[model samples]
Target chain A: MNEREVIETLKMIQEEKLDIRTITMGISLRDCADESAKKSCGRIRDKIRRVAGRLAAVGDEIEESYGVPIINRRIAVTPISLVAESSRTDDYLPFALALEDAARDADVNFIGGFSALVHKGMTGGDRKLIDSIPRALAGTDRVCASVNVATTRAGINMDAVSLMGKTIREIAEATKDRGSVGCARLVVFANAPEDNPFMAGAFHGVGEAEAVINVGISGPGVIKSALEKIRGSDLETVAETIKRTSFKITRVGQLVAREAARRLGVPFGIVDVSLAPTPAVGDSVAFILEEMGLESCGAPGSTAALMLLNDAVKKGGLMASSFVGGLSGAFIPVSEDLGMIEAASRGSLSIEKLEAMTAVCSVGLDMIAIPGDTTADTIAAIIADEAAIGVANNKTTAVRVIPVVGRKAGDVVEFGGLLGRAPVIPVSRFASSDFIGRGGRIPAPLQSYRN
Target chain B: MKAIITVVGKDKVGIIAAVSAELAGCGVNILDISQTIMQDNFTMMMSVDLSGSSVSLKELKARLNGIGERMGLVINMYNEELFNSMHRV
Candidate 1:
């Protein structure tokens, strides 16, 4: 190599500190189906435990040798409801418990696929599992659940949508002290995909093999730093640069994940090129918007910034790896992103603005810390709002908000590390309990009318 | 033949300048180049045509490989068809 080129590559490597985000093993539990819920749950748990026993250690060893940090080691099993067809009495809680046990045994932080793919028509098992979501989440600590109520192909499922609204309310009521802490583990999706590796939404698609290792990479700070360099550059140049930067970041993730999967003797799954931002000062999607010339994250140009970032991230990441899936775009979590928190605290960003941003990005109203006394009905209203966006747009969107207990406006809670910290932003003082308390579900979006 | 050459490795300075200089020396026309500098990593994709160049694809690949080895880089070369197909999706 030429001396000049060698030096340039070395400098980038030295300064960038790129690493892999998560090595998620997607395992299909389709074969674990049985007429008996207990037997099926036992088999499903055993299969996961046996197959993923060595996943974490292998990933760690590869990380040590390759000098790439594999931050999270997780598993995404088949949708639990698909195997609960035989449970006439609704035994989804036990299944969830079993999956949580498996996650503990595997020593992983989270395991996805406690889900139901009922975007078209609800099977008996799907209906049963949906009814049990509140119990499943409240009874278990680490179990996450997702329900796909709409899709571009089959249209939206109003029955499922209405059910989820009630399910969310039940989840809140079950964990009222934590402001619907159980709801934090649930996601309602539209156009939901099978290969997403992110939490509360990840699942093994039907087309996947027995098992494979996928990675989700995130670094909003990296993109924000690059944008800072080309402050005066033209819009087109800015777009091109964002794409190029995303390519490089995604390449690092691809390489690290490929090496990790290879070391573990598993097939490489995907690289979720999501720009997951943290609440750290410089590492935020909101920061990227500000660097792009926005006064605040929810300013007038927020949606445009999100659109450009999402497109560029996909264009660049697609070129870096073929196995790319999940919500491969910028994340706009208010509480998790330092800049967004500041914006919210300053009254610049609002729930309405954040929902608008979700039309472009993946996660909706993420890590948002609301007032401790926010009513369950209000939280349901928020979920319905985000779900409407997802349904209309035919995209996968999730809400992972924390209603900090006893925390009022201006109060800040420190989650520390990747979960980050956020200031408790005030919601509307008026209670939406009357609207949310109405037990009936909102009708499906107009887009869901396809036969 | 026209081809797209992708060089991926630890991010270091001068990789682009050196790669571009090499293409210029060979009388090759560089159509477009995109580069991103990430934390501790550098990735680049360059499109070049060698219709009038003296070196064959094999020789060009060998030279690039040598350069990559010396710089701790991984170099991959693909013809137009392969390049377009890999990114069609």
Candidate 2:
């Protein structure tokens, strides 16, 4: 390219506000597990601190060098449930506290992986961990938690799902003065991916190497701008515009991941090309999907609409980056997407339809609001069902469910800012403990094969 | 002296470990390495200290080129000055 072309390209990146969304360091905490919970917790804290100490500093240096903003520097560790398995009754609280301290020492905004796998049924340890979620989240400022309760292979664990529903309700009541917002940091899942870098969903997948770095990029503005330029254009043109826009966005992500991996001296992990939406207006992935001609975010043909959007995004992103992974699709987190919120407010969307849409996207039942009196076992069943979807399809999935205390359907609970607000969506009153009580690992699927 | 090593062409297993091992044999201290795969094409950059090498620049390039030929790779080398001018903003 000529000098003028080079100058113009630089200006485009600078002026367009294109920035790297996150640089997440994945730490393996398998080494932290010990027979005693206190010893295990201590090792986990030390491991996180030592391995992640220079993460923010290194990320900032690269951000300055590249002239791109690396918006967040974070860490995802091996699920704490695995590490905290040895906790005695007296040890669980301190173990959670140790995790909080680790995040502070590492200077990371959030430390994910306070999670458990209970798709089929809860083990004794899993039950204890599930029960401790409210205390763990309330006591810790930056530690995030998730639980998987469903998968296709084993079906949803109604028992665990029921438990989570009640747990969410309790946490909401416990933190009602804080807008009943304690569930903001918790996620439930079906088909949870092993290498997600985003949170309330990220955990060091069991398949990950000892340590690595994964990156997720967002470009809702880029896609929206592309759509805006071609106003009144036909659906094909809109789809084509989104495709081309996603291509450019993914190229930037590829460059950022390569440079970050080089600077950090770690292996380059996947680039999740998910069009993650925030609370801000004009940046919702669902809005872009809606612009492609859905009257509302969730309506008849919504799942098909979502499938097309998700497929086109992967097609464009795959062309731009060879290392694409980590739930590379559109996220339909209701509250975070302004268009979805508006649709829900107007009664164009509902909880049942959202569950149906989860069959195609990266998450299930995310940022949903239910009543305060919902039973714990019902929530557990929901998680179990979502896990079944993920396990069945061999795809990553998650749930960010919120139960608003004292808020019924049609009532809105505001979380403010990027966390957004949600209208209480009704849930089924029935419980599912009998199936959930059948405890065992769902056998690996028939199609599980690397060769 | 500092030097830059560039590798390009098709990607295959063991590319990174093999090249780094060859550099290690020369006692070359590697400062950094960046690698990416675009489609079937592989590209890499390695900054290394060339001091104390028994081989001359031409010979080192020839040896690296030979390794590349054996593995269907392309190899190139640049002086420290040129490398810095190209990369340093």
Candidate 3:
């Protein structure tokens, strides 16, 4: 290799926050079902340990060999609602605990599967799992839960959406001492991806192999730095610059994903080339927007800027890997991004502006904090709005807002480390209880006519 | 297998002699060396082949890291594929 190339790669790693965000092992637990909840829990733990025993060790070895950091090693199993159906139990708390125990034993950062997909309707097990989410997230340290309440083909399940609002309030109160941090470990999604390698939404789908390795690569700082070189570029030039940097970043992801899968003796899954930002300085998707001449993130023309970025990242990543999937676009989670946190703390960024941006960006209403007294109907209304956007546009959208207990607007609650702090974004005080009270389904939009 | 070694720190003498002598001791072959000084700081890049090295690649990295510590520099050895995959394609 030439000296210039080596120096550039090193600078990207040391200065620009270029790294693989996660290496997730997807394992299907469909066969671990039993009539007894206790027996099912036992089988779940043993299956996870046996399948992912060398996962973390292999991750460490690859990190050393490549001189690039792989920040998290996690596991995703089939949704527990399916596996626990055969068990004659009303509570799925034991299933969540089993997954947490297996995560600790396998040396993974988090385990996700305590999830239910009730996009159209809810089965008995699905309803039980949804009821269990509040206690499941509060009780386990390393377990994450997600509920998919809307899909483009099946339409929005208003019943599940309304229930999730109450579930989120319960989670916040259950873990209120920690600034409602439990809510950060849960997500409500519309059209959630089954093979997502990232956090609270990842799950091993029914059609996946027995085991696979999926990698998530993040480099918001890298793309921001690239944009700095051309100070007065046009919009076309800005898109071109972002596309080139994303290509280089995603190639490394494909490499790490390939090597990790090879050493672990599992088939390699897709690489999620997302511009996921962190709380660290110089590591934010908002900075990339600001670098493109926006006064600040969420300012006027913010939606246009985010649209360019999201499309360019996907185009570049699609060219770099033969198999690219997951949410391969820019993520604008407020608390997790430094520039976004700054903008929100000032009154420049609001929940309303964020909702508009989500119509074009990757995710929706992520990591925002709301006042404690906000009604469940209001939260459900927000989810319904976000779901309508995803279903109409035929894309993925999600909500993970934390209603900090005993906190109000302009009050900042600290979540420390990765899940940073957020100022409570004020909600409209006007009630929507009447609308949410009439629970039914929002029929599929006309866009679902692809037959 | 091949690896790239990079040294970055304040400029000083004997940096080359100390590094090459250690590489020779491990029976490693040096293919190319590039050294440059800018703004009173030292940066050196080396391309090395470890197929015939007596010690493992991990051992050689540890030895180089030890030398870098004594000399107050930041030294790193990375697999060449990291560069090839990102820059070549």
lDDT of 3 at A444: 88
Task: Supply candidate 3's per-residue lDDT for B45.
Answer: 92
Q: Of the native A-B interface contacts, what share survives in model 2? A: 0.00
lDDT of 1 by residue, A167-209 (tens): 7767767876655567667877876777777776788888888
What is candidate 3's DockQ?
0.76
- The C-alpha stretches of model 1 lying farther than 4 A from their native spots are A1-17, A176-180, A372-378, A402-417, A426-451, B1-89
Q: After best superposition, candidate 2 residue A138: deviation in angstroms?
A: 1.1
lDDT of 3 at A379: 90
Writing each residue's lDDT as its tens digit, candidate 3 over B1-89 gives 78899998898889999999999999989999999997888989998888889987778889999999999988888888889988876
Q: What is the per-residue lDDT of model 3 for residues A1-451, given as tens digits with 9 covering 90 to 100?
A: 7777898899899999899999999999999999999999999999999999999999999988888999999999999999999999999999999999999999998898789999999999999998999899899889999889999999999999999989999999999998888999898999998889988788998889999999999999999889999889799999998898899999999999999999999999899989888899989999888898888898999999999999999988998987898778899999999999889988889999999999998878999999988888899999999998898899999999999999999999889888888889998888888998899999988964655
Q: Rate the local accuracy (lDDT) of all candidates.
A: 0.75, 0.75, 0.92
Model 1 residue A384 CA deviation (Å) reads: 3.5
Query: After best superposition, candidate 1 residue A90: deviation in angstroms?
Result: 2.1
With candidate 3 superimposed using the best TM-score fit, by how many Å does residue A13's alpha carbon deviate from the native?
Answer: 0.5
